[model samples]
Target chain A: METTALLRQLSEAVGPPGYEAPVAELIERLWRPYVDELRRDPLGNLIARRRGSGAEPRPVLLLAAHMDEIALLVSGYAEAYGHGYLRIEPIGGIDRRVLLGQRVWVHPRDGEPLPGLIATPPPHILSQSERKKVPPWDHLFIDPGLPIEQLEARVRIGDPITFRADYLELKNRRVAGKAFDNRVSVAVVTLALAALLERTHAWDIVAVATVQEEVGLYGATTAAYGVAPTAAVALDGTFARQHDVGEDEAVALDGGPAIGVGPNFHPYLVDRLKEVAEHHEIAHQIEAIPRGSGTDAWAIQVSREGIPTALLSVPMRYMHQPVELLSLRDVERAARLLTEFIADLRADERPVWEDEHGS
Target chain B: MDFELLHRLTTAFGPSGYEAAVRELIRKEVAPLVDEVEVTPLGTLIAHKKGSGPRLLLAAHMDEIGVIVSYVEDKGFLRFAPLGGIFPLYAIAQRVRFANGVEGVVAVERRKDESKPPALSEMYIDIGAPSREASPIRVGEPAVFVGETVRVGERIIGKTMDDRIGCYLLIDFLRRLRTSRFDLYVAFTSQEETTLSGARTAAFGIEPDMAVAVDVTLTGDTPKALPMAVELGKGPAIKVKDRGMVAHPRVRDAMVEAAEREGLPYQMEILTFGTTDAAAMQLARAGVPSGCLSIPCRHVHSPGEMVDVNDVERAVALLLALVA
Candidate 1:
């Protein structure tokens, strides 16, 4: 499969936090043929399991990528000048400053995705002091180009609206689009499932597309509670460097996939990933998150009896924005590294640690 | 008998997820008292005192809220996000200690107009890491206040007093449990500030019949605060309710009656905000009757949380009476 095409399909899917059925269905269609059995929990997390031919008490390897993305919900609507303006609040983490005067696609439950643009006061009409203050999220509205009665017939209170930007291929192997913060990871996990299905792996592999990660990783917590895998890895995106951004803080876009290592990361799992990266010659960078990682790993590490977990993050630029960007090389590398790591684990043997202080 | 052990447990640096130091210290303290002790999968210390009866769990989280290195700027300055709920107003101009023994001061960026309290995003810690490579501190290292426990007019002011005080009380309680009616399981849990992960799992594994969580609550005596009924020097506060979980009615009444019979000076604690491990334990398996015995302290979740030493003694005494 073409990586860019998969990314495009993923970016075009509509799945916001707490509403992930459409995206989960799309992912199930894409990955069903590649795994032994596919299961979804009540939280709409799609888990594709490929069982090893080993005996009972087989060690399970869970590779998770969240399917939900940040979007807007229509809270209320009003009519002015024969056009319907929908009041909205962000359903996930969104920068209020970037929403001004941008085109969006509102996906109401009953009708087609309607086109709209963020309506804000004209800068020239505002006083100098008023221009300096950023408009609050409540002040912004979406003009959906329809009369109030017609809009009310189609749109509802909880309709999701996403940015209308198309996926763009940038220079130097970088591709940008909305929802790439996690959809790119979803595509990578799909590719890893494809790779693992072709070979006979030693451990049981579970490819999980979790939901509600953008909110608080709620989906991964419940899915982890149910799965209770011995070892797990969450594939997600990390902040990448842009112009004027702190270089020390940013992981480079093409630098490679990042391996999260620290107190939150299991030490033995980190070593295992490092060993697999070396063996497969995959380009990988080390990211140390000493405390709670604010990711699915935070929930996964402390699941039932505690699952030894690690995080594999593809560097993403402009995260939580309409135009999140990632390098294709990094995405493919993350998939390859995860595939190698899962294939290397043994069903009967536990990952070895130097001492009992595993963190 | 071992004041040094108590001092070591209090002075050791272990914030929420990174609680190895505190866990090790508690392990040493419980080695002689319990028959067998092991660290739980969630970094909680589960010490077992063998007896043949229903299981009773006593929980004290070992982790405290601190800061994690979020990003390092180009100029080698470190920006941080709090590991738990840290008041940005109190964080400014304070000292922090890194995991690698590096010291840093958290300073607010001087804006042209500074009227409002600095947002946590605008704050940075300067560890004197000249460059990204030389900093030794990576994005995700945990840092806490660089301070030691001290006695200030019958009060103990120290870093991580929120849960470490409870840890000390658990150690003292384990030492006093000679003939137990119930099989006692004492757990020093982790990540109580971030999520109740440690206690949740410990309860699932132990499957206790009843549980009592030991943690700290805010004192009403602090100047210009809400009118909470709890106060310092009033012994341990028997928690009625908090933002997280309501104390079990049976367990709450029992604790109150036990405190009254023992003549232990106790106060009714009503925490409008914040939670304890009792909340997580309450939701375990059909449900366990759970309650919290909180020590009233000033400036909870801060580096210099103030607690009265007499309250600590009373808290331990109440636990002894409940078990006896």
Candidate 2:
């Protein structure tokens, strides 16, 4: 599948944290040809193991990218003028500024997702002070435009909600959509797996479409423990340089992926990734993740006596918002860099601490 | 409760990544108690007492919230970023102690309007050095709040009681524990204040069948505090829901049953903000049923956090009853 088309489908998929089956199904179909074995862990992590061309007990390289997106959960139900509206609570860190005027989907237990519009009091009805303030979760409601009886019967409390934004293609190969904060990274892993089909590697590659990373690094943490890979790399999105974002914190869109370095990543793996990027002449940026990368890398690093984890992130604009933007070229570069790194790994070599290696 | 031991645990300089001091204290206290003990690469202290049943991982972080010097100014001022959640208003005018025992006062830059509290960036630590060259504290030095654990009537007050109190309770439980139906893996985790990284790995390594985190929760007993049902004088709060976790029903029920069976006065906690190590443990490896036992505290994330001694004792009893 073309990267843009796949990304668009991924962007439109409604897979909130704790409910990532939609995205997982898509990933399973796309990653089936490139991997040797595919299965879901008990916690719903999509694990695809691509065997390496090495002897028995081959070193494993785990690639993790969260498939879950930041979304909302219906917390309560209310009625205004006999029309039903639902209150919401955030599933992850969602900026309140973008919640207003967004179209959403309310997924119930046993029915097709109901289309809804995020609504607040009109400007004429809202007080002056209220107009200046972003509506609180309690004040904002999802208007499914259904009658009271139908809304009550169809939508129950605790239904999952997702942004209903369409993927938009922009100039300079940049695309805008929701859930690209991680779905693009999932695509990167897929692209890497696809690239690996034409090449031979020495280490086993387990590409995982991790779930519930938006809520916590649950999927990655569990997958790391279950896989116990020799080393792991997390693919995610970083903040692209945009208005109001500082230069130090944000990278340039379409420049390349950002290779994370800090406490969350082992020094040896960081160096190895940089070496691979430079050797391949892959355009990339060094992101100084002073602490946790707030990605699957954070959990994977500390999983099961600590896996040597690294993060390669494509830069995206307006992170955590409904209209996230990123470059397709950056996504491809990240995949290429990862594939090259994996193919470069030797059967005898393992990503460990510098001091852990023999003097 | 041993106030002296509590004092030692609370006063120890273990802030997030720098948890050696506190880890050593715990290791010394727990090494003799458990059958085996080991420190993970990320510095989480895991001690196991062998049992022939489902493994139960109990987590309590030894690390506390602190600040690391990000920039040392030419004028000897230190600009720091918070290692965890630090409020500028609550931290202003407070003293902080570095790992080397160098003390500095947190002070905000004088602004044109003092109506709103200063941001952390506008605040600097004054260590009394005249210039950058003479500054004893270098950049990247981490410092924690300088407050000693003190007894205020029936309540114990101190800094970092948020989880040190939890650590104390675990130690107390280990001392009193006679037998258990499940394999008890007590993890004195690191970096709960920052990333919960210690608990994350420790849980994975143990791969427990179930886990419970002992930590402090905010109380509404204070005047004009947020409307929570918990208070310091109340018994341990059984986790219901927090920002990070919706406590697994089975694990949460176990705690509630433990409390009810023991006839302990426990509160059902529903904290709208903040979370504990149980959130990380709950999702470790496929998934482990997990919940938290919260020690209701007044003024969380502040220098003068207070917890009731009675509540602490009750929590220990409840844990013992649960394990038994």
Q: Best candidate, DockQ-wise?
A: 1
Model 1 chain A lowest lDDT segment of ten: A350-359
* CAPRI class of candidate 1: acceptable
Q: What is candidate 1's lDDT per residue for B146-212, written digit by digit as tens?
A: 7677778788888777888899988988877666678899999977887777888788788999999
Clashes of 2: 0
Worst 10-residue lDDT window for candidate 2 chain A reads: A350-359
- i-RMSD values for every candidate model: 3.5, 4.7
lDDT of 1 by residue, A140-253 (tens): 999988898888888999999888889899888789999987999899988888887767777888888999998999989998889888788988899888898866566888
**Residue A314's lDDT in candidate 2:** 93
For each candidate, what TM-score against the reference?
Answer: 0.85, 0.62
Q: Output the number of the TM-score-best candidate.
A: 1
**DockQ per candidate:** 0.30, 0.15
State the lDDT of candidate 2 residue by residue for B143-170, as single tens digits.
Answer: 8988878898999889989899999999
* RMSD values, in order shown: 4.1, 8.7
The local distance difference test score of each candidate is: 0.84, 0.87
